[model samples]
Target: MSVRHDWYQSESKVVITVLLKNATEKNYAVKIGPKQIHMTADGYELTLSLLHPIVVERSSHKAFPSKVEITLAKETGERWQSLEQKPILVAPTIQTKNWDRLLNEEEKAEEKDAKGEEALNQLFKKIYSSSSPEVQKAMNKSFSESGGTVLSTNWSEVSKEKVTVKPPEGTEFREWEK
Candidate 1:
C-alpha cells in the first residue's frame, strides 16, 4: 500500500507530517538516525534521507491518531533547501495541511528559554575562566545592556606578519613615468 505524507520547514527545524490514513500507533514503527528516517506504517514503507545532519538527541516525533509528526532539529543554523532527495512526501491531503503552525506558542517559548539558558551558561564559563576580572566585569556590563545577548560582528585585523611586498629580483621595478 502506498503511504501519503507532508512536510514543512522552519528556520531551525523541519517538520515531517505523515498521513496516518487511519493507522494507529501500534500499527506504525519508526527508525530515526542522524541523517535518515525509516518508517513503516500499516502496509506502507517510507524512507527519507535527510538533506543535512541533524541532532538526533533533539529530534522527536509524535504519533497521533490521524497523523505522525516528526520534528528534526538542525545541527547548524543553516536553512535547508530540501528535506530529501526527491520532492516532499506526496499526499492528496496537502490542501488541508497547516503548514504555518508547527509548534505552538508555548512550545516555541520553551525552546527559546532552553537555548537562551544554554548560551548564557556557555558565555558565563568563557567569561569567568578566560577573562581577567576587569574584562569579566565588562562582559557582564555588556550582557546587561544587551539583555544577555551577543551580536557577532566582523571585527578583525590583517596580520602584519602575513603581509609582504618584495620586488622581483631579475625584473627591474620602475615607477610609471607621468
Candidate 2:
C-alpha cells in the first residue's frame, strides 16, 4: 500500500480603494508584501517599502474601474508561499447565572453588616441615656478598672476617687481595644 498527498500553490491580486477622512481619495500602489501589510488611515501618501526588492507602480487613470491596482512584479517570479492554518483554542465560558448568584450573596452580606452596626449604636445610646449620676460614677469606676478612660462634658465637675488598672506581666494585650 502507498500513501499519496496532494497540495496546490495559489496566488492572488487585489485592487483596494481607500478614501481619506479629509474628502480626498488617494490611490496606493500596494503590492501584498509577505503575509501582512500595515497602512495608515490618514490622507498622507505611504510607500510599502518593508518588503522591498518587490517593485510597485502608482498611476492615475480616469477610465480605470478600480482606484488602485496592486500586482506582483515580474521580478518576484511565481514564488509560492505556503499558508499554514492552526486550530484556535478558546477559553471555557462562565455561566451568567452563577455570577448573578455570587453578586446577590455579597450584597446580602453587606446589608446584614449595616443592620448590625445600626443596632449596636442604638444599644449604646440606650445604655448611656438610662444611667443616673450614681450609676454613671460606678460604671466609670468599673470602666477605669478595665483599663479604659471615661470623659465628662462638664469641665467644672470633679470625681472624688481615681481608679487605675495594671495588667499582670506576661499577659498578651491588644492596644487597639484600649
Candidate 3:
C-alpha cells in the first residue's frame, strides 16, 4: 500500500502515524523492532530502518479505519528530529496479481533469520570484552558448541592478540555450520 507517515517526538517518546488511504483496521500487521519496522497491509509490504533505536518492548500500535499510529518509548530522554534513516522514504505498494500474491513469504522468512543472527552477533561482539565472567564463559561455551567461525578477531585492548580461523588452503567452505 502506498503510504506516508507523520512523526512526532517528545523527550521520552516517539510516535509515528501512518496513513494508508485504502486500508482498514483489520487487514494490517505491524512488526516493531529496536531500530526497525515492518508492516504488511492487505498483502502490501512496508519496511523501515529507524535512525535511532527505541525500547522495542514499550512500543505499541493502534489501528484506525484508514491509518495506524505507532508509539515508541525512547531508550533515553532525548528528543529526535527524524525517525527513519532515509529522508524520502515512500512506502511502495507491493505488486500483486491477486491480493495475496504480493506477500513475500520466503523473503520474510529469510529476513527474520538473518536479522536474528545479526542481532545476536552484534550483541555478543559489543559486550564480549566488558561482560561479566559468567557471561563471557557462557558466550564462549555457546560459540564453541555451535562451531561459529570468525575469520579474524582482534581484542585490541586485551593485549592485541588476534584469533584466526582458516581452513586448509585447498578447502572451500560453502555450507553453514548447522
Candidate 4:
C-alpha cells in the first residue's frame, strides 16, 4: 500500500493518493466514498479524498492485497463520511511465546555456567592444598596479577620491572647552588 500527499496553495486544498492491491483469487468488494468498488484477483482500488487516508480491512484472517491506489477529492463545503468498520480484537501472542523461549534458554545457560565454575573451584582445591603457605602465596600473586580472578587460560605480555631516568647535574647549576 502507498499514500501520497500534495498541497495546492492557490486552492488551499490537499490531495491524498492511496493504493491497495488484492492478491486473492476471488472477487472482493471495497467501499470507497459513497461507491463500492469491486476488485477481481490482483485488482486495485483508487479513490480521491480531501481528507487523510484511513484504510480499514474487514477480515483479519486474510491478508490485504499487495497494492492499492486512492486519490482524495478536494473538500469543498461538504463533509466526508467514513465507511471503515472497527477491527476485530486481536493480540500478538506469538511474540510473547518467542520471548518466553528466549528467557528459558538464557536461564539454562546461566545454570550451566554456575555448575562449571563450581567444578573448576573443586578441582583447583584438590590439586593444590589450601593450607600450604607457598601455594597460598602463589595463588594470591596470580590473583593480584590477573586482577583478582582467572578469567581464561590465555596469557598476555605484562611489564614487571620499574623504569627510572635521572637528570645529570652540570657545573653551571653548581655555581648557583648554595
Per-model TM-score, in order, reads 0.45, 0.29, 0.44, 0.34
Which residue pairs show collisions in model 2?
Answer: none
Mark the 10 consecutive residues where model 1 has the least summed lDDT.
152-161
Q: Please give the distance, in angstroms, between residue 175's alpha carbon in candidate 3 and its true position after superposition.
A: 74
Residue 47 of model 3 has an lDDT of 82
Expressed as tens digits, the lDDT of each residue in 66-90 for candidate 4 is 5333332333434344323344679
Model 3, range 1-178, lDDT digits (tens) per residue? 5467888888888988888754564478889999998877875777878888999898998887777888989999866757778767687997657535446776788899999999987976888877776656555654453345432232232223333344457865455668
What lDDT tens digits, residue by residue, belong to model 2 across residues 70-101? 33332244444432223357879965578788
Model 4 spans > 4 angstroms off: 1-76, 79-97, 130-132, 149-178
Evaluation by lDDT, superior candidate among 1 and 3: 3
Clashes of 4: 18
lDDT of 1 by residue, 1-178 (tens): 6567888888888889988755564488778899998888757888899889889999998887788888999889887877886656677654564545755766898999999999998986875678666556555554444443432121121111222223456644344489
Best by lDDT: 3
lDDT of 1 at 126: 74
The CA lDDT at 80 in model 2 is: 42
